[model samples]
Target: MSGHSKWATIKHKKGAADAKRGQMFTKIIKEMTIAARMGGGDVEANPRLRTAVLKARAANMPKDNIERAIKKGTGELEGVNYVEMSYEGYAPGGVAILINCLTDNKNRTAADVRSMLSKSGGNLGETGSVSYLFQRKGLVTYDAEKYTEDQILERALEAGAEDVATSGDSIEVTTTPDDFESVLTGLEAAGLEHDSAEIAMIPDTYITLDNDGTRKVLRLVEHLEEHDDVQEVYTNLDIPDDYDPDAE
Candidate 1:
């Protein structure tokens, strides 16, 4: 779980460059649109949309862009219809991975994903091939700089959180997907701030890798994340502290 948190922090830092790429904004917009379309346009009633909006705001996406995306999703404006897709596979060291995507062209997206997997010593698998290794949960992180471990645990647990752990500078809060919104609201009401709150696939266990293996796994992940159709990549590969994927 700590490894996952560290990876997320790394991703957030990399989001600066990603935000400059229009494709990143497009992906976030697609997520917002779909979340609104699935539920209602009201963020208050739609937790997924709320989360998407939060992420967009964190990315510094413009207010007008956010509003327009919401309107398009609600059919008040034109928008591309995107379908959700997931590809499961194994990377180096037998690390299981699941790539989530939203794409207008399923055939192209699948082909591109499969090709990337094959190029990186992996093979795409049928649905459910790797999903069994994970459990859907709401994973929220609070910065320890702003809140103590005790404070985080107290507020989160009081709001029906399942577990809370302090790892380095972060306090990880885990809950059932259904309890995500309420738990977030609880933290907000208590004046507790969070670094990230989202629905995630928490793997049952992890496979640690050495320098070479971690490099190979990260290369595979970076390739997948660079794909325009890919929304997020979930994996059980744990990179060691000595191995820094971000180091120049």
Candidate 2:
């Protein structure tokens, strides 16, 4: 969990950078559209859509834009038909990688992803190759300042969370995928709001990296993330606790 926490911190920092560059909305809108298309647009009835809506709100996306994106997804208005695809691969030092993408043209996205991986000293693998190293779990994170470890554990455990870990400045609560929505509801009822809540790929084990190894892995992830269609990137490289690229 400590390893996961370190990556989470890095991801949040990177997300802030993306938001400033006007890239955040594009990704959020893609999520909204796909969620709406898969499930009905009624957020109350669609758990995925509800999650995406919350993300959009957190990002401070305009309400009108979210609605329009949902409408487009539901075919109430014209929009591109995006499909979800996943690619599994390996980064340098044998670190496993999994990428989630939503795109209208699968071929273009695949070619671009392959090119990026090769350029970054990684290579694409067949489906299920790297995915076997990860488990899909629901992760809900809160700032440590918001609650004590005991407090979070008691409430989150009673709320159906499977595990709770406090590392660095954040506390992460994990739940079975099926119990995620219920646990989230229970947490909200307890007057708590999460810093981040979503389904994530949790690696069973991590390969700790030195400064050079960390640089290689992070560079690969950044390139993968910068692609227009890639929604999420997961890697098993555990950054060294003392390594803070931003502080460099």
Candidate 3:
């Protein structure tokens, strides 16, 4: 269930996204609204809503704003009706792409995505074209400085996680999507804290790219990520360890 994207890619995206708090909030709010609408407004009863609310709190979103989003989702308050959508494509260097979106206008979103992909030297693929390259799984990340690999593995296995791996100063735990929240909560309740948790599309394998190929693929990913309707983008890029995207 571990994601195949490079550590450099993750670092680069996180750094950029953190600088755009408003955009980040918009994405989170959309997820919350959709989750509540699909599973009801009660967080305790809706695992998707529980995860969305947890992310909102982690981002320091206002309590009132969270409540209002839930109300809107429950139809107690008026709000935009967003339909969940996904697109599969291949970037430069054959990097598989999975884009999750929440959109009120599918035609516009599709057109924009297709245009961006074509401009970036990629193609918007038909259904199942690129999706077969990835699997849906849940991921939980922890601070490695606070726990040894052995310790994380021990705790994670006991909590029903399928696998654990070390990525620099962080430890990642992978679990079945259905057991993700329970495993995460169990670990937290047992004194193991996680930095972030999410259900994601993880690639079974990765493809290494040269500097030029990497740059092109990264640019395409950045463009797709910036789309207002895009919720998340998954890829199978494995960047070299020494490369610094921040330096660019």
Candidate 4:
């Protein structure tokens, strides 16, 4: 598993707490609304909306909330007009960072992101500056404790997954964006439960930093994620296997 993948697993474990505060729901709602507006509310016909709906279901979002968000997107009910925006930047150790957001006010979101970066010993870069370091890919992770490597390897590849690798305590499945849903469904049908699944901006190369540097970069990431408009934060920082995020 890459450092970012480890971080994602940690975040997934922390998601219940975040969801209790409604932070997770807020982000997912925005994503669903935007997906519906752009691709329409028909899940079977709109791939983007289908993905968003699947994420909402995975998060245990209420059926009523999901329907309302789709309605808002289709203009059946009033909704905020969100625009998708991405920011490229570098963290404390020159590790590349990409922040994806959906917001009604780009100015506020941009300024807030810049402030968070600057305060954390980082700076925003030009549009394509750090983006070139990442690629969009479909990633699905399963708990290593519950599933064997061989079991995942056979089922994942048979379902059209590109690669399956064991990293730390997790099994990572990689796929093209087009095949993500099918691969996920296949795994589910085969009785494999996943920890996290998403279409993510994955870094091509990762940078390893010392403890203090890692802490600083992660602090910045947490702050960005707390913002209402920020949806996802991607970075190239490779966290060491034994590093405990809660240890000072």
Which structure among the candidates has the greatest lDDT?
4
lDDT of predicted model 2: 0.82
Q: What is the TM-score of each candidate against the true structure?
A: 0.87, 0.90, 0.91, 0.92
**With candidate 4 superimposed using the best TM-score fit, by how many Å does residue 241's alpha carbon deviate from the native?**
1.9
Q: Alpha-carbon error at 178 in model 1, in Å?
A: 0.8
Computed on alpha carbons, the lDDT of every model, listed in order, comes to: 0.81, 0.82, 0.82, 0.84
Expressed as tens digits, the lDDT of each residue in 1-248 for candidate 1 is 23334434434433333423577798899999999889979988888899899778867789999999998889989889989999998988889999999999999999999999898888888889999999898878887788887888888878998888765567788889989878888988988878877788888877888777777777778788878889988888755546665555
The order of the candidates by TM-score, greatest first, is 4, 3, 2, 1
lDDT of 3 by residue, 28-132 (tens): 999999999999999999989998998888788999989999999999999999999999888988888888899999999999988988888888888999888
TM-score of 3: 0.91
Clash total of candidate 3: 0
- Ranking according to lDDT, highest score first: 4, 2, 3, 1
Worst 10 residues of 3 by lDDT: 3-12
- Cα displacement (angstroms), candidate 2, residue 190, comes to 1.7
lDDT of 4 by residue, 63-85 (tens): 99999999999999999999999
Better of 1 and 3 by TM-score: 3
Per-model tally of clashing residue pairs: 0, 0, 0, 1
Q: Deviation in angstroms for 19 in model 2? A: 5.4
